[model samples]
Target: MPMVDTGDVRLHVQRMGPRDGHPAVGTVLLVHGLLTDSLASYYFTVAPAFAAAGLDVVMYDLRGHGRSGRPPTGYTLDDAVDDLAALLDRLAVTGPVHLVGNSYGGTVAFGYAARHPERAASVSLIESEPATAAWAAKLDGILRRVQRELAYNETDALAWITVNRGHNTARLARGAARLARETTLVRDIPASSVLTEDGMRAVGCPVLGLYGGDSDLAALVPWLEASLPDCRTVVVPGHEHSVLVEAAGTVGGHVLALIEGSGGRGPGRVSIPGGGGGRASGAAGPAVR
Candidate 1:
């Protein structure tokens, strides 16, 4: 368990690579979403796959989540981006590298790429949209609802999910409830801004997007197509927002492909254990990653 001090806070960070000891071509940073999400989301799922594919993998618990120092404030998007920048700086991770983010993590990746295009080699977004006014407003509504539910009925909500939903669902609900009850996540996320159209257009790196066919965020894929200069997307069938969990192998395959392509390397020969070929047909062209 290593923690990197980013001046403002200390982030719980982990670095991993292939057990066979192949040299890593470039770095791949994994960022998770809001609420109950943590570095573990990627740590236990896709990080090892990237490592096995010969890329240095980095993942950190965001402020107010996991084992990271949880300051009461500084949970906004700008703060999140700054934290990433500082982490990279502290780790001496220069040059362009691939970024893989899930949900809100994806939004941070987009924002960071737009802010510092020179440092990003490529980006892979999972079930995420640009932080636009519309997204911010929509997120605000969702956060408010979560805040309301957590403020008054968190225990009941957890109990209800435990009985009605599966154990994983109950666990996630409990974690979300505890975080909501303890941290300023509910207050800070709603205050963050989604990137504008111009901001989205500013990201110059190639991007790979993975989304669930049935996810609410899938609607943002067309917007990504219209905005990013080079974007490839895949919509996995029979999945939803939890693509990272439901289809980790598929997501990991695409990500390894992205890293391999970005580094101008040959195909990475690793199989996603339970991952299917979750690629949607007619994905802008043949799968580049």
Candidate 2:
């Protein structure tokens, strides 16, 4: 738990690596989705691969999420991206970094890339979408569910766990309230700022659009590939929205291939979904879906 001062914002960020290492294969800045902040989104996965690959992995809670400061209530996709940009600037993190965003994180990533193409190495989107009326409605439902769960008092927190999002619920009650109060996703995603899928095309780096190959995978993938020239798709044969927590290593392989390049220069067909995939980095792929 470390805090970085960005003049106007005190970002609560987490880092895992040596102070000085390989100048970082480019920092992997992960943005979590609705109801989830840092750590909860990546604690068991991804971080290790980036660390093992000798890259700096950084994750921070957006303005009103996690432990970050929450002023009255102001959170928007544009503002979240700006905060991210500011944090990077303050840390002197240069060059485009591999940006991994899940759920709503993907929304901010798309916005940031739209505004600053020079700041991205690549983008890995999980169970995500460009905001549309349909998308907004979908999110509205999830937000309502989250709010409902958060209503549980300490006495019923654990009992409320089973119906919630996380793959694990040992800390469900407290985590739910944290998520409920961190309404950045609710406050920002509902706006039209997130409706610009065209923005994804402006990014100057590689793009990996992933889906939980289950019945829920929207036509968004084909639509994205059709719209964004640099974008590609990967559908985990069997998975769902919370795929990250379910299958970390499996997901990492596909991500490493696209963003960092799997670099899996070995024997045989190294076909890791996403045609633009790189050589396998020796790290096993995480479970998809």
Candidate 3:
């Protein structure tokens, strides 16, 4: 584990290279979701697989999460994107790299791709969407509810989560509560400037979106495909927002397919079946659910 000072925030980063002293095929940056999520998600799930596939893997804890430096302010989406850029500069990863992001991290990855399209080889979003006014409103509602239930009613909330979601989830929720109560994360994220449809369409890199068939976000697949120029989406059946962890193999396989497909030429709509034991359908073709 190494900590890199990005001038503004110190990010905790982890890197995994191809095994057997082989040269990496390319680089893949993994970004985890907000609160209760860190590089550990990818470390425990897809990071090793990506590395084993001969790709350089980079994972980092976002500011105010995991082992990263948590400032009281500056938790906007823009701030997170800046942190990614600064981290890449510090690590000297100059070439175009595949970007894989989960949840809020997906939003950050999309923003980075939008801002630096030349450096983005491709983007894979798992259960995520681009930042928009609707996204902001959704986040505002979720954060407010978290503040009310978890922060304001801490003991009861933790107790309920422990009973329902298990002790580990309760522990994570505790940290999330502290983050919401102590920092400006809840406020800044909702207030972050959103991207217009034009802005999203401007990103020329190949984009891949993976969504859980049962997840509400699956509905956004059509919009994403329609919005991005060279975008493809997969809907993994019988899962929800936690599909990244629940079906790591499926997610990683789709991402790797996108990375490999985008290597020489532009990626077209292709359906790759049976990578991590789960079946996936292309959202562009038919509705999975």
Candidate 4:
């Protein structure tokens, strides 16, 4: 277990380089979603594939999640963005790097791009959106519900989750309950500052949005394409919010295309199947070698 003390909080970090002593084509930083998510999501899914494809991969547990230091405060989006910047600085990776974020992690990645546009090579948002007013409100409602149902009604909630979502999910839910009860994460996140339209438009790097066709978030594709300077989106068919985990191949393919298109060196051709209103055929194209 590797950890980096970022002055603000100690973040649990994981890094993987290209196989067989090959130089990395580029660097990729993977950020996971809030609560029930950690670097494990990408580690078990896309991280290895990216590394095998000759990209350096970096993943970390955010503050108050996984094995990272949880201060019971500083759970704002800015804190997350700052942590990323600091982590990269400490790791001595100063060049612009590709960023792949899941759910709330995408929001943080978007925030990082907006804040430090020069350092972001590209951003791939998997079932995520920017930290806008609407996003904040949505998070507020969700957090409140979690605090009420998971924290306030712990025993019943765990029992229900164990029966419905299985013991693994129930165990994760138990940790979430402790986080919500012991930390200010539920409040700090909603109160974090949101980005304005101008702020969003300032991020000039290439952006990729991957959403499930059946997810309500698919509705944002049009807005994302319209808002970002260089934005492309894909709606994966027959999936929902958990698309990254459920459809890692599709997600990995699209993300690899974005990374290659952004200037990483690779032999294969990059082709994205869906954009805007189009739906992906569920083929993730050729596997990266």
Q: Taking the tens digit of each residue's C-alpha lDDT, what string does model 1 give over 36-59?
A: 678988877788777876788999
Compose the digit string of candidate 3's lDDT tens values, residues 38-129: 78888877888788889999999999988899899999999999999999999999999899999899999999999899999999999999
For model 4, the local distance difference test gives 0.82
Error of 2 at 85 (Å): 1.1
1-289 per-residue lDDT for model 2 (tens digits): 6888877678888887645545566678888875434555675566766666667888888776667776544466667778888999988888888888887787777667777888888888877765556777776776665556556554454344433444455553465466456545455555545445455567757777777666364356666666676776676655567667665656676776776564333322322233222322221123232
Worst 10 residues of 3 by lDDT: 266-275
TM-score of 3: 0.90
Q: Count the backbone clashes (under 3 Å) in each candidate.
A: 3, 14, 0, 0
Q: What tens-digit string does per-residue lDDT give for candidate 4 at 1-289?
A: 9999999899999999997898999999999998777888888777877888899999999998889998989999998999999999999998999999999999999999999999999999999999999999999988887777785677876554344221267667777677888999999999999999999998999998888877788888878878889887777888788787777777887788788884322213222222122224532212100
Instruction: Please give the lDDT score at residue 214 for candidate 1.
Output: 70
Give the poorly placed runs of model 1, Cα more than 4 Å off: 159-172, 262-270, 275-289
What's each prediction's TM-score?
A: 0.88, 0.78, 0.90, 0.88
Q: Relative to the unseen true structure, what is the C-alpha lDDT of residue 208 in candidate 4, on a scale of 0 to 100?
A: 88
For lDDT, candidate 1 versus 2, the one ahead is 1
Residue 5 accuracy (lDDT) in model 4? 98
Report residue 37 deviation for candidate 1 (angstroms).
1.2
Q: Give the winner by lDDT.
A: 3
TM-score: which is higher, 1 or 3? 3
